[model samples]
Target: GREAEGDIQKGQKEKEEKEKGREDQEAAAGASLGEEAPCSRGALLSPSRKAWNPGPAESKLELHPLLNRWALWFFKNDHSRTWQDNLQLVTKFDTVEDFWAMYSNIQLASKLSSGCDYALFKDGIEPMWEDSRNKRGGRWLVSLAKQQRHSELDHLWLETLLCLIGESFEEHSREVCGAVINIRTKRDKIAVWTREAENQEGVLHIGRVYKERLGLSTKTVIGYQAHADTASKSSSLAKNKFVV
Candidate 1:
């Protein structure tokens, strides 16, 4: 009986020691896991769990805001659709970067099909002459030859846009409504539309500034035609209300 009891006591002690060994190994494994590098844990995490790291501040471009928010309109000639239906509002942009981004991505004025037009008007105003802000206004007409479409058209149009967004007109900038580039088979026309036709001083100043910016020769005379005269005219023979 005494011998049997000794054997049982030894077996019980061995079992307890094995259990202690297993517990110690488990505790050590947990400690090792806690001490592991962050990279190891990051690998197990989902993509969304990771923090967002923005690009370097110095490399990011700060966009320049323009004086006025402008809306760009494209008019495609369609026999089936009315004139109003053909005009589409492409987008409105208030920043210089955004404007260039849009301009660079779209077809150039010279590239648009004939009878089409590109109009840049102040936000909330339609490009039509009938718009309340434009009904009494006139445009400083720049008639471009067919040959000049490829060479000078784009440059002149870009300068016109820069003049507008840059507010190059100074005090008379308010008188300016927008500009239009009409692509035609016979001749492409560019014009700076102003808010008032009766204000002779403002009209002449805008025309002179526009012509100079366009790098037009002194001999090249551009005329201003009132919306009323244009609306009444049956053909291209609208009488010039003011000439510069």
Candidate 2:
């Protein structure tokens, strides 16, 4: 029994070390981007990395409210279920603290099974292109190689979500509809869906700001595709209306 306990403890220590290493890597990436990570407050770490125990039950903690209330939706690709049935509304939050709390409690994007997706959008907006707000719009799509899912996917996804809730696009934020992360076996994608594809100024501005916020290299191009086009064809075959 004592020997078994020793092995279990050693395994726990190794797991802790791996978690710490992941956190360090994310921090370094954020530093290179000239910004602090959205999870820097230890919000994104695995449960083993830190004990996230709350204080007194009646404790009053001040919450920083966001300009918009956002809804989080999860889609698990289950052939047994209808498309709508597979999509579930996880929760909605309007405060920064609440967002962090929700994020800390959920499984990280990178950990989601292939074909799953996580979407964050303004409270009333559904994630589908069929939504009235999204019908006439387009998306700024960033495709990631399968190799990047392990090292870069989670960080990029969180940054995208923060950009949405943080209003990182300044005045163009009004054009923002939401962001989606699609997990795939071959390659993954993240897209910021906006309300008007015809509003070139707003769309381009969002694209520029989003790319920079993701710390993507200037040479690494991202494309904006209209919902109309994407609806008619596979994403791979859809032509980009704008690139940044």
Candidate 3:
């Protein structure tokens, strides 16, 4: 017991020493004779007793701000349960760092099981067709073959996300609602949904920008379909209102 207590004390001392070293570095970075440098409260307090507080230069990581906060949803298919029951909210993130952190931790789009789906929508909006913000919207669909998943799914998904966060659609960016990636047995689908399907200029612009960003071949045809049509269709087919 005494040895264990001694070990604990040694660990605490080492921790305190490391902390003091960090504070000293911060102080050296923050100290400037004629200039005010930014320092955290802890850094400032740590070296108050020292005659010379030389804080280490602040190594602040500049985080890029996204145009909007996005929520990521995951749907794991369960034949015994309703579709709504299978859909679950994974997480919501607003900053660039948080987005990447979440993205890196999750299973890659290509690796997900068939019948699963990943949806990223602006905060406060659900990814379902019935959501008020999405009811009037339509998605620019990019259907990828099963083979493409191994080669292109993850890259395409990242591009779609960048388009959303970067506001790459120009003036039409405001019309953008979110994006979705559906993992299916036959084909994997990636779609960027916008708020108004009827906004021809915005919809087409979003589609062109999206398709170009994904580097889709000219021979590859992508379609845009209204949610209304998608919702009412009995078959898995919906009429394409526009194509690019």
CA lDDT scores, all candidates in order = 0.74, 0.78, 0.74
Once fitted onto the true fold, the runs of candidate 1 whose alpha carbons sit more than 4 angstroms away are: 1-61
> If both were scored by lDDT, which would come out higher, candidate 1 or candidate 2?
2
Q: Model 3 — TM-score against the truth?
A: 0.74
How should the candidates be ordered by lDDT, best one leading?
Answer: 2, 3, 1
Best by lDDT: 2
lDDT (tens digit, per residue) of candidate 1 on 96-147? 5466556666798989999999999999889998899999998988998999
Q: Clashes in model 1: which pairs?
A: none
Arranged by TM-score with the best first, the candidates are 2, 1, 3
The parts of candidate 2 lying over 4 Å away from their true place are: 1-59
Mark the 10 consecutive residues where model 3 has the least summed lDDT. 1-10
Note each model's CA RMSD in angstroms: 25.4, 12.3, 14.5
Better of 1 and 3 by TM-score: 1
Residue 116, candidate 3: Cα error in Å is 0.3
Report the number of the highest-TM-score candidate.
2
Inter-residue clash pairs, candidate 2: none
Alpha carbon lDDT at 133, candidate 3 = 92
